[model samples]
Target: MTPVSSPYVPDVSRYTKRESRAVPVGPIQIGGGAPIVIQSMLTSDTMDTGACVREALDLVEAGCELVRITAPTVKDAANLRAIRDELRSRGCPVPLVADIHFKPEAAMEAARWVDKIRINPGNYADRKKFVVRSYTDEEYASAVARLEDAFLPLVHLCQERGIAMRIGTNHGSLSDRILNRYGDTPLGMVESALEYARICRKAGFHRIVFSMKASNPRIMISAYRRLIAVLQELGPDWNYPIHLGVTEAGDGEDGRVKSAVGIGALLADGIGDTIRVSLTEDSVREIPVAEALRALVEEFAGAPRPKEALVPPFDPFSFQRRHSHRWVRNAKVGGGEPVRVAVLEENFAALESASAGTEMVPELGYRPGMAEEVDPEDPATLAELETGAPRLVTVRDGCPYPPLYAFRMLAARIPSRHPILLKDTFFPGEKGDPLRERLNSALQVGALLCDGIGDAVLLRREADPKKALELSYNILQATGNRSFKADFVACPSCGRTLFNLQETTARIRAATGHLKGVKIAVMGCIVNGPGEMADADFGYVGGAPGKVNLYVGKKAVRFNIPQEQAVDSLIALIAEEGKWIDPPRS
Candidate 1:
């Protein structure tokens, strides 16, 4: 499939949910300007009808609008009937979804019992051996015909039964055809899903949602933006609601930051209709995080004041770090250096006392007042920029636009070679509510970092510098801008998980947490493990109930290692690859 080019970047000047065809999932509607829906998948076994019912009730009780359960087999798909029946009897009328992969028969069976069916287009009808091959035009057309035959049956079943579908594409699971055609790119991810979507569209089935999920926050954000642009080019009727998530976003604050940066960045501009904060922890715990992210972008409902029209100078569908010449002797804040941390000299005096145990030292301690002030609302400031000597610049305070857009406006007008000091608080010396400050900083500043706009970041008026430093570094790591510690990509636990994901992830972190720059993926199952951690250097994935499969960049080197011995083997594998180091004695 070829990508259609369109000048359809989200307007950063204000926040408004993107309009889409309303997709009815049971009693609730997604998109068409409906309230952003929150959903999560069940982690309990589908065969355990009692467990499944209990889990569904818990999610519904926690305010989850939709619940998804994995149906990897026909038997598992059939059991959804019992699960649905039990939930209805218990007065829980929440919608149910069947998560299907590589199984059309199971998807068809699942369509009969659930309100929605989510099929990975990579596996719906196409084969993926990760082989290097090319498809001739006729062969490619034949493949599309095959996909049509396999997918339209379920589309017809769904249309007839008043069911919805999500053509959810995973970065790690593209078909050989798509991979050979588009490589492993954001375009590839979009095309993979659009092929199936076109099949549905031709059959007059439009009750569909689309998602482009990747573990990398940058990739996840870019793919969603690209997906929207393509949809716009396709026509107005193709306004399908988007499902936003960063798959295998790990757990805890790390997971939250990853989810927020990728999903929140889009949410700031009103791109998602529904969201799932994928975490490696409890599925129920995901709801409140989703709610918080949903609320954070609510201010976008209207402009605080008249704002300038959005005609950004950067590409929204791809990340190209804003070019800047090295301005500092340390070369830490520009000219291809990792984004630096900063504490303005005025704030430094206050933060120095609270910084006893913190390792972070701002690279530039000069007062922010000393930098060139770029007023975002004024185009004259942008045109005045000179690229001769590298200048340190920061957005002027009281700019009508939010940080995400303000910096975007700042970035558009500046000499591309000047380093920018990204600030968390635009107001100087005012200690606002800590929670609000944190959310604004994480969502707004984090979004800019993902856009490759920041060269240095500071939580300008944050009450606690220690906490601010922690949050700043985490955001940088989450956005793939820098890594100060060992990184991980872990999927939220689901019914298909073969082993105890939470406990295993804990164990892996305990042993490998100190390996800075080494990214490890802990997956509960093979379904998404190999492909999901698109960036991890090593992998610990569940091969079976009592077994583990260890990988070195998607290649399984050790299979069925006893669960008890898996960690040791994984460590040995890391050591053999010359990527392991003894943790510093503490």
Candidate 2:
């Protein structure tokens, strides 16, 4: 099959930064060297006008530049008008975005009331039944024609109303046609959004943004990079501002770390214009995290230019683990070993106490016989290392050099066979919270891992060792280095979800949470479940009312099992496949 052509390029080195055309959304301007914008979504029912307005106001006050609300139907889309009117009346005139899925009419109606409209091309005019079929040239052309017929009105309407559109494509939600042709990969994601973008361009609708979202950071980062490459090939004028996000990132540390890895990886390459940290927690809490990520990206982007042109050691557009030699036999630090997690404490006692019950290595800056820790300012000290253990290099915030460049300089001075432990410290002080701290660490530390620079990561902050350990593993997981716990890839509940996603996810997690290295996806619907859970070891997806489907790596093994017995059935399937390990005796 011929590869699809994209309008953007993946060559980050070609441009000092990704220079995009400024797309105006209400009073806000995105891209074209503008400050990266922060965005969040409202979880309240759209029909509940007061609730929606209240959430929107809260989001704006929390530093959200753009607020999005779901519009699953025409009634919900119409309700946005009331929400917008109330917000405007109340002095909160933040740009509102209508999130549309499988509803073109809703998109048209939403275009009139909102500053921007976001539509999922996988389902806007196409139904995803996981059907697989080959389309002839005529059939494919007919499908495109039909899609244009359904989508053009909204395109024309948005253009006339000066409303920007985001052709956001979800990894799990690609149309059957796209999957049949592209096999549900990142290429499929780029093609899905490009189809709608081509339509928008033909209609002279240039005010558009594109996003390629996924639950998996690897897939998400790969898709966005591929989209850029395709877009660069399309034309200079086709450089649309890209929106960055990781869909269904679970709450707490996991969510923050995942969002940071996917969004931060692209941002490090200067690829994102607007970003939303999609956490399962209240949308208001997402703002600070997004703020921290943006700040970190800006810090790196504004770093002093290297004295000489430095090419990246690894491909920025693709995912490849850095090659290294293993350090220890039992605790492998590098050389195809899982990225290790270490705890950096103020003292040896504190490090030992914090890492007592875990496999996490403990390192102290001042302890003798411990791993060598060097400050970025003093590189000559690296030559004095007498111990053969991997060195623990601390790259604290407020360093004179950009973290990336500093790492490169350190690598140049050190021996190639010596594995290095990257420890990133953040002192948020009065300007940060737990969420901000988490995001900052992920961006700084996770960015290095994505670039294949670190073999182990130790995040140091003024928090307990347990929390730090959890965060270190999360960073490793997000960077696709390790999997500590059962990877729960659950979607944030939306209008299309048929069952109680949160409750079901909780139950599934309770039963299988102990299965380390096992990936189980709990999806709310079939729209993107099978395809989205492509990386999962097992899947529990909603099939119909009061029914569920069980999948083993994207292939359905059982159909329509009663929801009550679904969990047990899933466990049984896992055991039958020899992946089940019983919980230890309490």
Candidate 3:
């Protein structure tokens, strides 16, 4: 596959900051070289003015720069005026964004109230029926014409109301028209938004932001890169700010790892203007993750750009692990081996016991008596260790140097053949949770893994060791290094969902928790399920009320099964395909 090139010319800078025209949203600015903005959405019902105001205020207090509320109907859109009034009365005048799907009238009403309006291009004017049909040239043109007729009114309303607009394209939610035309790829995600962009430009509306989001980090990163290339081709005047996110990133460590891998990878390339870390947890909990990611971009923002390293051998557009010699026989890593996992424990007995039956490599701090383990921070000790010993080198957190720079320095000095373990520890100062710490660790360690630098990862915190181990593999999974458990890709429930997404996702995960090396996507609806779950081994999607659709790869093999029996049916399908293995006797 051809490597995707950066949109900007090659430079010494780590990221080629995509220059964009700053669009004003309320008192703050996005793009145009503004500091990367941090934003979050309120999960409270929009019609409940009190609850919406309280949540909006809470998010703003937690350092959220912008707040988004769902406006599913004309009434909900109109209710935003009341919510804004209550917030202003409370002396919290933060900018409000109305999230609209499939309702132009709601969008129009929202444009009149909120500081910005976000419309999903996949469902803004088109309904997703999961139908596959061919459209002739004239028919396609007519459809575009109808889309413009439906969307132009909102464009004009936003322009007149001085409200900015975000054309957010979700990987799982592309219109059937776009999917049929573009085959549900990154190109389709970009084209879906660009189609709306074309209409906006024709209507002379320029205060726009664009986002290409996906549950998969690779897809999200690739789509954003391709979108920038397409925008650059359109001309310099079309440089709209990008809002970065990984939608439906499930809760806790898994969510953080997934969000960081997708958002951090793009931000490292200097691609995002504003960011939202969409966790399945409380909306307020999302602020710290966003702040941590922003801190990463800021750390490099003003520093002198380092000289570009040797052109990497791997493709930038796609993921392919970098080649390195497989030096350690006991703990195999690099040279196309499955990425290893390492656990950092001060206790020798615990470390020894943990490594006995598993592939986990044990890492310890420097001490004279412990000859069996490797000291991750000290190069001299590592050099003295007997050749071929089961050594796992560590690059610790809170180093004097930047973490990635520290890793590079260690990599340069150590033998390239040795299996190195990357470690990150977060003590979320007061007022922070373990979730925030997990996100920080993921961002710190994940950055190196994305460049194919580490063999294994060790995420440490004051929390449970098991949680840390889980986080280690999650980071590996997010970076596409390894998968120790079934990968669950589910969307966070939205107004368009026909069923209870969170509850259903939990049911699916509970039933399949023991299946290793499998990928299952539990999607709330068909809007983007068939396409977004394209990489999944099997998919359980909401087809209709109390009905589920099952997929093997992208092909929907079973349609409209009762929701209550969906999990059993999915397992039966997996067993039929000979991919299911019974759990070991406990």
Q: What's the C-alpha lDDT at position 129 in model 3?
A: 66
Q: By TM-score, how accurate is candidate 1? A: 0.95
State every prediction's TM-score relative to the real structure. 0.95, 0.84, 0.79
List runs of model 2 lying over 4 Å from the truth: 1-17, 135-142, 344-399, 408-418, 425-434, 495-504, 525-528, 541-551, 555-578
Clashes of each: 1, 14, 2
Could you list the CA RMSD of all candidates, in the order they appear? 2.3, 4.4, 5.5
lDDT per residue (tens digit) for residues 7-118 in model 1: 5555666665688989999999999888999999999998999998988888888989999999999999999999999989988889999999978999999999999999
- Choose the strongest candidate by TM-score: 1
Instruction: State the lDDT of candidate 3 residue by residue for 20-55, as single tens digits.
Output: 899999989999989999999887767888888888
Decoy 3 TM-score against native: 0.79
Model 1 lDDT, residue 63, Cα: 87
Error of 3 at 358 (Å): 6.5
lDDT measured at residue 445 in model 3 versus the true structure, 0 to 100? 77
Compute the lDDT of residue 147 as modeled in candidate 1: 85
lDDT of each: 0.84, 0.76, 0.74
TM-score of 2: 0.84
Q: Tell me the lDDT of candidate 3.
A: 0.74
